[model samples]
Target: MTPIGFVHSTRTDATDDAWDAEATTIHLDGDTFSPEALQGLDAFSHAVIVYWFDRVPPEKITTGARHPRGNESWPKVGIFAQRGKNRPNRIGVTTVRIVDVQNLSVTVEGLDAIDRTPVLDIKPYMLEFAPRGTVSQPQWSKELMSDYWRTIQSQ
Candidate 1:
């Protein structure tokens, strides 16, 4: 499918994880997109950005994994189960705050995508539609989920 738009962030690689911690500005590529595209977007405090991990090294996927969450103590989980950069589609979804919007640039809080990431879609945040009641997560996901989410943001 054709990409409808793209995301622009300061950090260009996964190694530069500081962008989330420092609140770097993120811009959208659709400079001429209609304002209607952002309808009701400001009502929520946050949004979910779906994007492609374009720069991930292909060898990472071919070479297999290096342990889940970089923890060798944990069993070897497939790349798909964890947030491995070598995902089949190399797509990433991040929830970030809508700091401001001007023209087509959306200034957001904590999107973990690298610079020039291909944005697949943008969805508004709604607690009712969130994962609060979802139980489909794996046992390891449930156990290793962060207790301090809002404090430290990442993919």
Candidate 2:
């Protein structure tokens, strides 16, 4: 599938953590879409972004179970059980704060994507889309994600 837009950010390398400090702008292809596409997006507080993992190499893709971050303390889990980028589909989805939405560009805070990442789609986040029932997970998963969404505060 083709990309609807591309990310613009100072972040060039993909790190394991500290994504909440990254602020990026998603510039929709003006030639393919018009300003009306994002007209009502500003009304939303957040957006769910679907992007392609263009940087992950083919050999890195795995289907078997492995420890998260290669930490032996964490139990081995299947690819689908975790949010690693080594999955088969190589697709990434993230919910980010909508900082500003212009005609064809959307500035978002805390997007876990790098510059030039191919954005497949963007949808405004709604409260109704959240989980309805209780959410359960192992202690290891919680520890693994303890700092995944922490923002870097200025000194």
Candidate 3:
């Protein structure tokens, strides 16, 4: 599939967590997506961004059970159990707050992707799309994501 756009952000390297503060700009291909394409997007407060994890090498793809973040405290689970970047398909989807939408560019907050990441698609976040039943997860998963969006403290 063709990438409709690319992500422009200050982050260039992959980090284990803490992407909620990163401001990002998704620059759509002017040739493919015109300003009109972004019409009505401003009405939405959040968007679902589907991007390719191009930086993740094929060798890193894991299908077997493994500890999340390699932390022994976390129980070994299948690849699908965790939101790790190393997967069979290097695709990442994130729900980010839309800061602004102008022309062919969209400014977002809390995107986890790095600079030059290929954006596959963008969809508006709607309440109807959310899970209907109770959401459940293990305690270890909660601990693993406790600091994912928190600001890192300086030494």
Candidate 4:
């Protein structure tokens, strides 16, 4: 599928963690999209971004899982069991706070993707769409995510 837009951020390369602190502006393709396409999006506090890992090489894609980040402490599970970027599909998703939506661009915070990342779609984050019951996961997964969404601390 073609990208509806692309991300503009300070990050030009993907990093392992601590990317949540930066803000990114998603520039919709003017030739295909207009301001009206993002008219009501600003009202939402958060949005779900479905983006592509265009920079990841096909050879690096993982179908089976080793320890998350190669940390042996975490149990090896199927590739689907983890949220790493090296998945077979090379797709990424993140929930980001909407800073502003103006004209054909929307500025958001917390998207982990790098600059120029193709955005396949964007959806408002609604409470009704959230999981209804408690979410459970392995203890190792919890530790793995402790800093996954953390802000970068300035020295």
Candidate 5:
């Protein structure tokens, strides 16, 4: 598939806690595109971003038992059971509120991507598709998500 453009953000460097990173504007870079590429984009207040965890290490992909908050004694669950950075494909998705859009740059809030992370695709969030069922997340997974949100709100 052809890439219409690329995403540009202030995150030009890597960090340990990629999920806790600050929100950055996702600007469409490179060659121009038809206005249709952005049609109806402003109707939504949020977006689903698909980006590649380009900086994740290959070896860390098998973190079987990890204390998401750095606490071990807990059960050593599978990597998929946790929100750890390492994974088979190292891809991450986040929903962020749209702040503004100017030409190629679209300002948003609540993205967890690290600086310069490679964005694969972006789609406007559909409220009808949002999760509404009960969540049965593992204890560690729940805690990890809570910690990250808390950290983001504090910043």
Candidate 6:
């Protein structure tokens, strides 16, 4: 699928995990997606951005079990069990707060993608789409994401 837009952010490297501090601009191709496409988007407080992990090499794709982030402290688990970037399909999705919606561009916060990352699509955040039942995950998963979103200390 073709990317409808690309991200513009200060982050170029993937070493940092605190994404919440990142303020990104999704520059849509006006030739493809007109400014009218963003109508009513500003009404939403947040959105779900679907983007490509273009930086991830094909050799990094994993279908088998492995430690999350290669950290032995976390138990070895199937690729589906972890949110690692090295997936069969290098697709990344993140819910971000909408900072602004301008012509041919959307400014967002907390998008984990780096600068120049191809953005596939944007979906408005709907409460109905949230998990209906109690959400549960392993302690390791919690530890893995503890520092993912930027905390006051990280900023």
Off by over 4 Å in 4: none
lDDT of 1 by residue, 51-134 (tens): 878787776553355566676667777775677667877878878888886655677877777667777788887778776664
Residue 132 alpha-carbon offset, candidate 3, angstroms: 0.4
- Candidate 1 structure lDDT: 0.67
Q: What is each predicted model's overall lDDT from 0 to 1?
A: 0.67, 0.91, 0.91, 0.90, 0.67, 0.91
Off by over 4 Å in 2: none
| TM-score for each of the candidates | 0.73, 0.95, 0.95, 0.95, 0.77, 0.96
Taking the tens digit of each residue's C-alpha lDDT, what string does model 3 give over 1-155?
A: 89999999988998867787677999999989789988999999999999999989999999899999999988999999998889899889999999999999999998999999999999999999999999998999999988787655521
Per-residue CA lDDT of candidate 6, range 70-155, in tens? 89998999988887788899898999999999999999999989999999999999999999999999999989888889744655
Put down candidate 2 lDDT per residue, 29-120, tens digits, no spaces.
Answer: 99999999999999999999999989999999989999999999999999999988878989999999999988899999888888999999
Error (Å) of candidate 3 at residue 140 is 1.0
Deviation in Å, model 6, residue 17 alpha carbon: 1.3
Off by over 4 Å in 6: 151-155
The TM-score, computed over Cα atoms with residue i paired to residue i, of candidate 3 is: 0.95
Stretches of candidate 5 off by over 4 Å are 1-7, 10-23, 32-35, 63-65, 150-155
